[model samples]
Target: MSGVARQIDRPRRWLVVLVVAVILFAGAVVAPSTGITRMGPFGLFAWASWLHVFGYAFLSLTLVYALLVSPDGPALSAAIVPIIVVAYGTSLELLQLLIPYRSFAVGDIFADGLGTVVVVGVWTYGQAAFAALGFRGS
Candidate 1:
């Protein structure tokens, strides 16, 4: 395959996952009651909205993992992912306000941002440690 095609293949799955994640999360926010998601232990007996952040946290970890696996991945993308996460979370909270059942809460944003921070910090630190040891592969 040509260089461009090969390059495209690498991030193609990322793009797909990114889109699906956004859509699914959007669906969760647009009609949270219709959308049912469970996080098992991560739920911690919290409301589904809160546990939804936990799901995003895991999604963030997947994105970070994909970024780490890519040779051309940059720290800038690692940093920006959290911003995307925060913005997405902010938007979701705003959307939730429209739902009669869901009220916008500062707590949700805090939870989402906290999750984003944890994912980015852990991912970045792991990348640094792996680079030091010359580890590779997803």
Candidate 2:
């Protein structure tokens, strides 16, 4: 491979590790008790549901950075981010056990997994859509 290629790819090893670290670290912080709800037709799925979209957004950003460094495409990054997220999430849940006001909620893990699926789905579809629009890449 070219030296330039090596230069680009080499940094990604640490970049991925760093991004994963930041995500995991951030998850440990207890979220303020902001009631995620709404009064719309499907209120139950409004605010809390929106969190999934935010998760997708962050995951997408992470994928873009992943691609920028390695050019491996979003699919590969999508496949890996969740494992990092889940391990970190589970650890955070366990860590919260130490707090007097918090308890582990398995539903949060399900929500996180669903959010991850959303991220992967959007990345896959986004790549397809961009290709359909005549964009292609390495």
Candidate 3:
């Protein structure tokens, strides 16, 4: 690692990731079209769905790391991160009900949850593999 990289702390890195994730989440929630309607005939399987997956997946990972690095972070177990991510997705769907151009779609929530789950699952598997190989970093 470079001296500059060593100078920056782990918590600071997690904070930056968390902030960017929040901004992305806010954008996805507020944007009017989000290119969903433009993907005609794709509907649930649209590029929009893929966008949600990737967006929320990164969001979930950031949130987990953020919580992990916080001073009082240990109060909330990391195991709850997936549930929190899914709940956030559901809340976003509910909020869309109030938006004129967006309707509350359960499918969107599912896509978000699926995305978070896939990412977290892969991360968990990777960590387990590393542990089995006697590698420590996660």
Candidate 4:
């Protein structure tokens, strides 16, 4: 493909990734947790906590990638992506309150925020390092 075509397609690809990530997150959040802890190596709360971290981390990364690939994306994507992800996480947690089988947990929010911060921090620093080494990054 031509460079122009590739450039135009990048944002679309990332947006698709972002959408998939969101759908997966919602599915995992709303699904019944009956057998999850028993199946996972980590017991009970640990498994759920790790899920919160990894899920939000992936979601945040996809969001950042989508924004970064867009021509008119925000100048401070690293700053905004975490806020967006955390807010989304919080909203999901609040939604759990209405579900009879699901209850809200503040710890899950903390895990989500932790994941967003770690991923965004590493991404920002990795981009800087690549730039310092004279490499172009997206």
> Clash totals for all models, in order?
0, 0, 0, 0
Rank list by lDDT: 4, 3, 1, 2
lDDT of each: 0.68, 0.60, 0.70, 0.77
Best by lDDT: 4
Question: What lDDT does candidate 3 reach at residue 11?
Answer: 58
**Using Cα atoms with residue i matched to residue i, what is each candidate's TM-score against the true structure?**
0.68, 0.59, 0.72, 0.79
- Name the regions of candidate 2 deviating beyond 4 angstroms: 1-28, 34-41, 45-53, 56-60, 67-77
Candidate ranking (TM-score, best to worst): 4, 3, 1, 2
Give the better candidate number (3 or 4) by lDDT. 4
Tens-place lDDT digits, model 3, residues 1-138: 565653465657667766866775575567566566455344547877776788788877876666654433334655677798888778777877787766787777887888888877876677679889998652
Error of 3 at 22 (Å): 3.3
Residue-by-residue lDDT tens digits, candidate 1, 1-138 = 577875887687588558757764665456455434454455563565556567667667766655545556543568877777777777877877788876787777777778878888887787789989998644
Query: lDDT (0-100) at residue 5 of candidate 4?
Result: 80
Error of 2 at 71 (Å): 4.5
Best by TM-score: 4
Name the regions of candidate 1 deviating beyond 4 angstroms: 1-5, 23-27, 30-50, 65-69, 73-77, 136-138
Writing each residue's lDDT as its tens digit, candidate 2 over 47-72 gives 54455335534654564456433544
lDDT of 4 by residue, 73-114 (tens): 445668998998889888888888888878788998998999
